[model samples]
Target: MTCFAERAPAVVACAMALLLTACGSDGPAVVEPPQETTCNGVATSVRMLAPFESVVLSGSSAACFALAGGDREYLVIPQLTGELLPYGGYGFRLGDPSPAVVARAADTTSASIPSLSAEQIFGDQVHSLDAQARLDALMRRREQREATGVHHGAEQPTLSVIGVPPEPDTMRTFSVLNTLGETPGYSPVTAKLRYAGARVLVYMDTLATSALSTSEISAMGAVYDASLVPAVMTAFGDGSDIDANGRVIFLLTPTVNALVTASACATSGFVRGFFYSHDLSSTAATSNRG
Candidate 1:
């Protein structure tokens, strides 16, 4: 089989070239690369991966976009703050059928989170306030909501802990098999990486029999870690840090693997990923990262 390095020469070269350019700068003072930003109420710029082009949709969040290319089409939505629930299907809640339950139902493996406290996840990041104060504020808000008979959904809640970041390193790959049992037009075995960046949810029209191998999934993750992550962080004005705020969802169609089984779909032949920002007015550009 051809390795990812052989197949994606340009990806490797571009990444190295960018690094070299930064290091080779002659100035004694560090020269920061140009940053992208957006004004309030303005449309945010989206960075489309590869062949994916942006499409307009009404009544959608500023980050919502309909991407299409070749035979692949899907929607990308970036949530500002919400629970990063595991995927079971449309309407699937996180604890209703927990990650383990979902994996068992699908007859596939599930990702596991290491036993790390919020402080461990965000090492050295100072807390915005004391834990007691935050908890008091939370209790007050809950009391007000309860008295008013107003209840927020499971996914909608203000983040009480401000310093804890999502540890992407601990996020493992899991498969969602028998997806047809829950929702149609979904991949039979969907690979998911659960992290704590708001709750970026990616929806794609996957073939019933299509699935990515473990190696392919690793390759994709490497690509994300190397190229896409930096671009996304820069676009959001978060510098080069991976543990930044906001969310990004990627909609992909596996086309390179000849091992893929035949399946029916409305479209075919393209793979795409999307980046989003918390502020819709944040201007940024999309590059072909995957």
Candidate 2:
């Protein structure tokens, strides 16, 4: 009885302490405040792209061109950014895809035809064929050209092309792969139509394009979703899912290209050349894989 009496107050005090800890405070649980996302020096123009996030792709001034599809676009941001330091492509005027034309001056020799990877010519970030695997594709192409006396044929060898740069004596016209692998016809004689630049050419296959006016804007959108988007994804993977959503969103805009329709700019006061609108609320069957 003496021992029990001695320990009773101590046990009661311990029980009281446990009860207080379990009860916590009379107010409520504390929560850390949500973090705020801010773009410090982001221009109002770039900031207004969307509420999610954005980045400025910088390197060279915007190279402008008119697409065979009647949509003129420019190279504002590089496709691969830094991985491929000089990321530029041949800008063929709007028609059928063809082999590169090395119109060297009579004084220049065949040895002057500089060789380059297929990716460099076709904009690997948008092309289907992998360049690294086919190192001698250019040689095979030359052989095929010699045998058939044809620059382009049904079996289009895509792996590499002659890296013909702009020279005072060499007026070379390189072919570029459009959305559907068709050429956009003869490329214009531009001073910047060389092997080195900081822009990626974006254009559609001439064969696939119709007389696209503002009325048939939905057709253009369909082409973009079906052909253009998949090509880009194939070229540059799906990219990081920055929004944490299962789908990836790619926002492509030309710093100089004009919007397709007035209706598109109704909501945002401006329109991007191409953008993905994944159905976040839908299932795999209905939702697009951005």
Instruction: List candidate 1 segments past 4 Å from native.
Output: 1-157, 160-191, 194-210, 231-236, 239-290
Candidate 2, 179-270: lDDT as tens digits: 12222121221112111211122232223234343235445445545555454453345643323333322222232123213452332233
Instruction: Output the number of the lDDT-best candidate.
Output: 1
Any idea what lDDT model 2 has?
0.24
Candidates in order have lDDT scores of: 0.26, 0.24
Give one digit per residue, the lDDT tens place, for model 1 in 10-111.
111000001100111122532221122221233223223332233322112222111111222122321111112221222211111111111000101112
